[model samples]
Structures are given as structure tokens and as C-alpha cells.
Target: MTIRLGLQIPNFSYGTGIAELFPTVIAQAREAEAAGFDSVFVMDHFYQLPMLGSPDQPMLEAYTALGALATATERVQLGTLVTGNTYRNPTLLAKSITTLDVISRGRAVLGIGTGWFELEHDQLGFEFGTFTDRFEKLDEALQIILPMLKGERPTFAGKHYRVREAMANPRFRDHIPLMIGGSGEKKTIPLAVRHFDHLNVIAGFDELAAKIDVVKARCDDLGRDPATLETSMLVTAMVDERATPDLIPSGMRQRMVVGSAESIAEQLQEKVFDAGVDGVIMNLPTSVQGYQPGQITALGAALKPLTAG
Candidate 1:
């Protein structure tokens, strides 16, 4: 259930020809595993995100890529940073992750969140609902997913979903850890305290401490130990010494860490870890263009110890 240091491959625009695209991804995943990363994640999106590039830019289906990743690497965990709950049926989503757990020999992590990204929904024919509608769907969907992940057959009917004795068979383990990604103190944090094993705090570096404190307060209100809920921050990372702060988009500047790998590690330890977040999941968006031979390995080496006890 731990995410000591995770690498997220958020883009697929490697300059290489199509033939070398996946090989390049495999190289990064292997580098992360070899450098002692605990997990690897991909964004669960149907199109390239606005922050990264145009809608038509290269993007891979999250589960398909994660399934392929399961076979390519042996040690590090595989998952989406957070699967959009509105993309698929709850029962089916449960089956998909359970199948991945079986394939990866129990390395699956069920990271999920309320669906966002309006364009994907509008273009893909999925319903584009209000934010509250999406969160309601997520809440009811988890009622089905959580029990099935634990090998139970759940039968329930809710406002947004209905399941009749839904089951996921051939599970690799009795439980597949559940992770929720968000920073909303009212909805997201309380939901995490109720159901999730991990919380991937999606907030700016300056706001991370406040979010962590909210998580702690939510746990306290529920009469639960704050330490029981693992916490991590999703940070935009720059590992190359040549990378300057100007390369970061102005809107994303507050969320990014730039410098040499060692200095980036120092910033994360001081800001994220010291703020009470248990770990970090970093996305090096620039690497989609190209990465040096040992760049990811070097970054992983510098950051893994920060998450270790």
C-alpha cells in the first residue's frame, strides 16, 4: 500500500518513430524499477491534456498501457495516477484491475477519482455532468468496487449505479490497495478517510501543507489514526541541470520543482515530506521529448531515500 517514490509517464510524444515508442516507455519503467522506485503510473485520459499539448497529440489508453507495462517490468507497481471513475462501469472497472493484479502477480493499485476533463467526455460520448454529479457517481461506484476488490459479491442499487451480486473472480490477493487522488477538504479528504488506503494529494507545493493538515483533521474526526492513511503528492518535476524555471508553464510554475536531481530532491524533502505527505509521485513532462540515458535513474536514486523510514 506504500508509494515511496512513483514515476508517472504523463505523455507519449517521444520523437522516435512509432516502432520505438513503446520501447522508450519500457526503458523509463525499467529505469525506475532499477533505481528503486516503488510504483509507475500513467494518466488515465483519452486525449492529451491541455497542459501537456493539443488534444490530438499522442495518448495511450491507461489500462491497456498498464497491462502491457505489467509484462515489461517485474518489480515496480503499475496503475493510472488516478482512473476516472466515470469512464467505465464500476463492476467492469473492478474486473479490469483484478485482472491486472493477477497478471502482475499482485502489483495492481486501484487509483481512482471523480472524472474531470470535459473535452474527453464531450468527444468520447461519455456523459459530461456537473462536478457534484461526477462525485456522486464516484461515491456510488466505490460501493461496488471496494467490496469486489476484497473478494465479496456486492448487491446494491444506488441513485447512479445498480449492481446485483457483482463479483470479481480469480483475484491475486484478498485485497488490492485503493488510492484516491485529490485535495478537496470537504469531499475528497472525507472520502479518503472513509474508504481509501492511500491519498495522492493533488495540490500546489505551497498549498500541500494545508491539504495534509486537512487529511489529518478528517482522520481525527473519524476517530482513525492519521498514520493509517498513506499520503503522497503529485509534483511536476524537472531533473536536468540545464532545465530552467522559465521552461515551466506560468500556470504550472507553483506546482513544479526545478533544478539538478539533488536539488529537486532537497526541495521535495523540505516542502512535501516536511509538510506531512508520506511520499511523492513525480511527472517529468519534458522527458516526453527526450531524456538523457541516466536521467530517471539519477532522479530516482536521489528521491527514494527521502520516503524511506
Candidate 2:
């Protein structure tokens, strides 16, 4: 349930050929583990987002990649940063994560959110409903998924989904940690308070404090301790020693930080940790240029003190 330090591998489109793609990913995950990160995450997308690259850019299926990562790295938890709920059936998603937990000896974390990519939906043929529709679907999906993860066969018949005594077998643990990602106060935070072990905050830097306040307030309203629901911010880190503000893209400037190892740590401590978040889950979009052998190792070293217990 705790992810004080997480490394997200959101870019797979390195300059290398497809043959070298996954080996590079394995190297990053393994390096993160060696450098002291508690978790490694991949984006759950079928195509690259517009901001990152062209839609045709290389992208791996999230859970399939995570399952392979389970065998490559030991001691680091693995999962998607957030799986899009519309992409898979609830029962099937449960089975996927449970199998992951067993394979990793209980290092699986179920990170999900209401699917939002219109392009992916339109092209991939998954139903892209209204905002309210997607949230409602997620609510119902959780009703079915939580029970199956707990080793109970739940027969849920909601408007969006139906399951008859659906089960997930050979579980590594009765519970796999659940994390919901998004910034919506109305739906995302409330549902997170109701069910998830963590909330991976997706917000602009200026909005982070208010989001934390809302999370605490929501927990208070539900009579649950805010500390019981851990939180982390998703940040894109440019880890080069020569990193400068101009290097960050205008659209992503607020969500990203550009600096060396020490300076990056300082910014995170001031902007993120000092903003009162529990932890950080960061990705290096620049890494897509190609793998720098020691990039994650250096960043993870600087971040360890901030994430230390």
C-alpha cells in the first residue's frame, strides 16, 4: 500500500530498434531497484499520447509488460501508473493483477483510472462514453473487483457491468494494493477514499496543495483517517546535470522539473514533499532519446532521503 519512491517508464520509443526496446526497459527497472526505488510503473496505453510523440510511436501493452518485468527485477513492485478502465472487463482485470501478485510474490499494485484518451478509444474500438458514464462504470467495476481480490465470489449486476460469482484464484495475498489516479474532487477522490489504498495525484503544481486539502477533507467526511490513504504526485523528471528550464516543453513545464541530481531533489522537496504529499512517482520523458545507463541510479540516489521512512 505504500509507494514512497516509484519510477515510471512511460516512454518505450527509444532510438534503438524493437529488439533493444524491452532490454532497455529491463535495465531501467533493474537499475531503479538497485538504486532504492520501491516501485516501477508503466503507462497503460495502447498508443503514444500527442504530447509525448506521434500516435505510431512504440507502446507496450501495460500488464503484459509488467508480467515480463516481474521476472526481470526482484524487490521492486510493478504495475501500470494507471490502467484505463474502459480497456478491459473488470473480472479480467482482476485476474490479471492477481496473477501478477502471485508471480511477483505479492508485489502487484492495481493502479486504475477512468479511461480518458479519446484517440485511443476512437481507434481501439473501446467504448468512449461521457465523463459521467466512465466514472459510473469505474464505480461499478470496483464493486466487482474488490470482492474478487479478497477471495470472495461477487455476483454484481450493475448497469455497466455484470458478473456471476466471478473469482480470482491462486492469489498471493488476500489483498493487492489499489491506487486510483486523477485530480477530480467529486468522483476520483471520493471513490479513492471509499476503496483504494492510495491516490496518485495528477494535478498542476499550483493545484497540489488544494488537492491535498480536498483529499484530507474527503477522508474526514467519510470518517477515515487521511493518513490511512497514502498519496503521491506524478512528475516528469529531466535528470541531466545540464538541465535547464528552457529544456522543458511549454505544455509540460508545470508537470515537469529540469535539473541535476541535487537540484532535482531540492525542487522535489520544496515543490512536492513540502507541498505535503506523501511521496513521488516520477518518469523521465527525455529518456526516450535513448537509455542513459546510470540515469535512474543517480536520480533514485538523490530521491532516497526524501522518500526515506
The alpha-carbon lDDT assigned to residue 158 of candidate 1 equals: 95
TM-score of each: 0.97, 0.98
lDDT of 2 by residue, 74-141 (tens): 89999988999999999999999999999999899999999999999999899998999999999999
Best by lDDT: 2
Query: Pairs clashing in candidate 2?
Result: none
TM-score top scorer:
2
Clashing pairs in 1: none
Q: Candidate 2: where is the Cα deviation over 4 Å? A: none
**Candidate 1 local lDDT, 1-309, one digit each (tens):** 788799999888878877888888888899889998899999999899887889998788988999999999999999998999999999999999999999999999999999899999999999979999999999999999989988999999999899899999989999898899999988999999999899998888889889988988899999989998999988888777888888887898767888899999998888888888899888786535574568788888888678776
State residue 46's C-alpha deviation in candidate 2, in Å.
Answer: 0.5
Error of 2 at 56 (Å): 0.8
